[model samples]
Every structure is written in C-alpha cells, then in structure tokens.
Target: MNGRMIYLIGPSGSGKDSLLDSARDALAAQGCRIARRVITRSADAQGEAAEVVDPDTFARLEAEGAFAMNWYANGLSYGIPRVVDEWLSAGDDVLVNGSRGYLPEARRRYPHMLAVLLTVDHHVLRQRLHARSRESAEEIEARLARNAGFAETLMTGESDDLCLLDNSGSLAQTRERLLKLIAEHRLPD
Candidate 1:
C-alpha cells in the first residue's frame, strides 16, 4: 500500500514551523514523517529546520533531479528531497511544508494528497509577523493582503481534498487538530 501525502501550506508567520515542531513526536508515533526541506538560506535561518544550500548548489541539485518537488518563492528555492518518494512507497505517510502557489503542480503529481491550509486570525497573524521581524511593516501588510485573498478563495472553494486547520489558538489545540486530521485522512491498508 502506498502512503498518503499530507501537504501543509500557509502564509509566512502562520505557525507552520511551530505546529510541525510541536506535533513532530505525535506524527511520528502515527507513522508520519515530515520531510525536511532543502532551502537556499543559512542553516541558522529563523524558521523551519531545513537543509541550507547555496543558490548554485540548489540549481545543481535541481538539475540532477535530486528533488521530488521544488519551487522558488520569497527569493528562496525550496526542495523536497527525493527520499520522500521512497518513504511513501514504503507505506510511510509523508508530510511536507509546501507552498500555496505550488499546489497545482503538487496535486498533479500526487493526486490523492491532502492539502491542509493552516490559518490564523488576521490580528494574530499580524502580531506573529511583527514578532518575527523578518520583514518590514510595509512588507507585512502586503503579505497580509495576499494571504487574505488566497485564504478567502480556499475557504470558499469546493475542493474535497482541501482541509482547513485553524492555528489561531494555542499550539496545543492546533496540534490536536493536526493529529486528528491525519487520522481522519489516513489511507486504508
């Protein structure tokens, strides 16, 4: 039996990294492996635990077909190592911190993948972004605008494969919701 793909996506500062970190053990106990991304950024970057690579190295790896999936966003390149394919083939569910813009391509490749959108209340999101201090106030506003539109579209869309997980509350609540969502979508043996 092939394992299912759980594609988790959300705008920056929506707590994707935090949720993944907090729920890592629970997810593993449930037979799910979170794919560590190869990103073109410093190892000490303030975000998810991703493999850091130079732009040239990333380009070379992409050319060599080392990634199962890859895309460029926010001035950085992100890749999911091809090992994920092997994990899924071995009947281990795989979760990826994926991109919203790359959803179409991901869906095309993994037709049965569950697309989970982690959402937060606008005020909470703004506060998180401000606390992160990764972007200027203007940039944060622009991102919030974009997130609002994209979120609205997703919420209203009739996509059966899409799951909306709100992360507006405590990390504990979001972690429980995440685990439950995984259980609910687990593939039958």
Candidate 2:
C-alpha cells in the first residue's frame, strides 16, 4: 500500500481540532494515525492539542530536518513531525491538522495528500473564538483578518485541490463526509 496523507487545514475557531479528534477515533479501526503537530505555543494553550516545544528546541529540530512542513503564523511556529511521513510510508493512512500558509509546501512534499478545508459561519466563528479565550482582543482581530483571505480562496475555488467543508452543522455530518472521501480516494494495490 502506498502512503496517502489526509491534511486538514482551517483557521482558528473553525473546529478543526474537534473534527480531527472525532475522525481520529472513528477511523482508528481502519488504521489511521492522527499526526500530532509541534508548536512554539506553550502546552498551556487552550485550543490546539499539540506538542509544545520552546523556540530553541524547535529551531534545533527544524535544523535537523525533523519537520515535514513547517511555517510561522500568528507569531508562532508550527510543524508537522516527520514521523507522519514514516507512518504513511508503512501504509498507514495519516491524518494531519495542517496550516493553510504551509499547504503549498505540504503539497510539494506529499502531492497525493487529501486536503480538507473547514470553514464556519461568521457568527459562529466569532462565538467560538470568544469562547476559546486564548488570545487578546487584538490578536483575535488579526486572526479574523487573516482568515478572511483563506475563506475567499475557498469560495473562489482557487484551492481546487481541497475538499471544502462548512462546519456550521453537526460534527457527524463533517465526519461522514470525510470518511466517504477517504474511502473514495483509497489507494489501489
């Protein structure tokens, strides 16, 4: 079996983490591994369930070529550990919660990757972000401004490589769609 990566990309408050966690459990029996991201954010961060590393360690790891794809966004560094590539090579389907800013590089590294972009209703997004309470008002504003461009690209289909999902509905709806997509795109022997 050839490796096929499933990359989930979305902005803050888009429910990417929740959706990924649900799908991870649902797909575990099928041998899918959810790749844990390495981040410069502290472990105490509220929303993202990532492996937190300091700047020095992150630089050392990046210098050692440990990350498959890494990027700086919202003043923080994020990386998908190279172990995901290893898992995929072993024929296990690996799911990654990736960054929109780094999608091009991720595609170049794993062209066959199934990229899923999750979006949310503007009102819902605002509510979710407020509830998360992870950042100051200024930071939240910056995030919304950044997210707008990504949303526009999805609406315009500039990202034809991605399967778009509006997560304004129940999570079950999103999960089933993703499972179906994976089944449809399953690699042939």
Using lDDT as the measure, the top candidate is: 1
**lDDT (Cα, tens digit) per residue for candidate 1, span 114-172:** 99999899999999999998889999999999998888777776466799899999999
Model 1: which residue pairs collide? none
Badly placed stretches (over 4 Å) of model 2 are: 154-158
All candidates' lDDT scores? 0.93, 0.84
Model 1 poorest ten-residue lDDT run: 152-161
- Measured on C-alpha atoms, candidate 1 has an lDDT of 0.93
Model 2: residue 102 alpha-carbon error in angstroms:
0.8
